[model samples]
Target: MVTDQAGHPLFTTSRDRVHAEGLWHETFHCFVVNREQRIVLLQERATGKKDFPNCLDITAAGHLLAGETVADGVRELEEELGLVRTLDQLEHVGVFLEELTLPGFVDRERTQVFLTESNQAISDYHLQATEVKRLVAFSFDAFATLGDETTTEVVSIEGERFGRNRFVPHPPEYWAMVERSIGQSSM
Candidate 1:
């Protein structure tokens, strides 16, 4: 389903057309934090994926299928990362306009962001092999400094070392907003 800039549902359409035509659609982004809230989870996208393959991205995220409400999107955590969580366990950060245009694709999403606290170890995650490769955690401070030259830490995922360049290149402002939200949530 397509939505207006204000995230009001307008009409239903196929997912392909939504991306191909840059139609606004609803998606969910969940960021997982450790018990102490000092670390945040990150997942590496599967290498075979079409867009942003093998890049480090949000802990777990997915599109809200047509007719799905924001709460329904919580299933993405279980579907993508094997973490089952109830709606009450999640804290809604806010809605965001996330738009990205590639040569052959345009992703225009009205993303409902959520945060959840978990102490689960990365090795314990049952990753969806087709969508997620492995999970990694970064210190909140270090992640907040992402995209800056001063930030230099290799992210190790299942014995593989990935540098900052391997991450999805979200704009600096996006990282800043996420950092602020996470910080506030931690307290």
Candidate 2:
């Protein structure tokens, strides 16, 4: 688990808290896109994770270490997603909050959202076993429809050794937001 600048758990100050003591901790989130207007990606979190297992998060995301800046953590995409894009290749989409409802979860993050465009096939890269379990590709619309219909599609993991596939259902509003983000990024 990642800690805040104060070296404390983020759940201590979530947005939902009246005094949100931990909300002061900063974090970042980045999104990637392609020229075809496709949002670059999101991975199916492995079920063994401590939080939000098997859920869909940003195309590429991680917490900023206690002394790290939002940009520093966002740069992890090159290693996590195996993209060769530079910091300039990423475009910030401002910040967003993903509050946790698991009571006393003491977490509120200032997500530094970003967007980028790339055509690189993810199959060439490797998946971080600790962070992601597999991957899936869908046009923004396809995901939107799946979200609205509660359809769980398959995601395949490509990594250093082999790949694994699994089915997942994601939030519809997220794709709707992604579509809008992609549209805005293209502009």
Candidate 3:
């Protein structure tokens, strides 16, 4: 298997591996935790989408194309949220695989996660219209209680109305990384 400079696996085939085919588009997701650590901003994907439509998910996330470095998070920050960021502004928490099976295609994604603390509200953001629709900020503790199958869901953002399971999207590993970072700072 061919690999990029970072050693991430590239695209392939049975006989000859098509480098362009498996260039592996990467994505960045930011968990903007507030000062009191009470609220976390969440995004609601627009209804008109081919994959993961209308899901209540992380605050801001997007893919990093071929040749894009993980450090491009700063640029992504500006493009996705129209905010400026320095390398020190964002904490590179972790990387994890997020797999999703849509109707025709499957997204086996390698997501680079980040966390930052700020008083800035997303209301000041001018989001990318093609990718993002609306934003929702919720309390962190309350969000943890969500996705309870036994509890009745008043509104299903990621699941069908009749579906029993509440989908808490995003890999738990990413969150765990942020917790680790906090632990380091306390020491």
Per-residue lDDT tens digits of candidate 1, residues 70-135?
889999899988899988899888887878887878889888888999888888888999999888
Cα lDDT, all candidates: 0.82, 0.56, 0.57
Candidate 1 Cα lDDT to native: 0.82
Give model 2's TM-score versus the native structure. Answer: 0.68
User: In terms of TM-score, which candidate is strongest?
Assistant: 1
Backbone collision tally, model 3: 2
Write the number of the candidate with greater TM-score, choosing between 1 and 3.
1
- Per-model TM-score on C-alpha atoms: 0.89, 0.68, 0.69
Best model per lDDT: 1
Task: Give a tens-digit lDDT track for model 3, residues 1-187.
Answer: 3335354757533211222233334667776667464565666666675456767666677666456666775676677567677767787776766555544554555677777666676678777776667666655544444544344442323332422132334454544555455444321
> What order do candidates take by TM-score, descending?
1, 3, 2
Once fitted onto the true fold, the runs of candidate 1 whose alpha carbons sit more than 4 angstroms away are: 147-161
Candidate 2 stretches with Cα past 4 Å from truth are 1-22, 37-40, 144-176
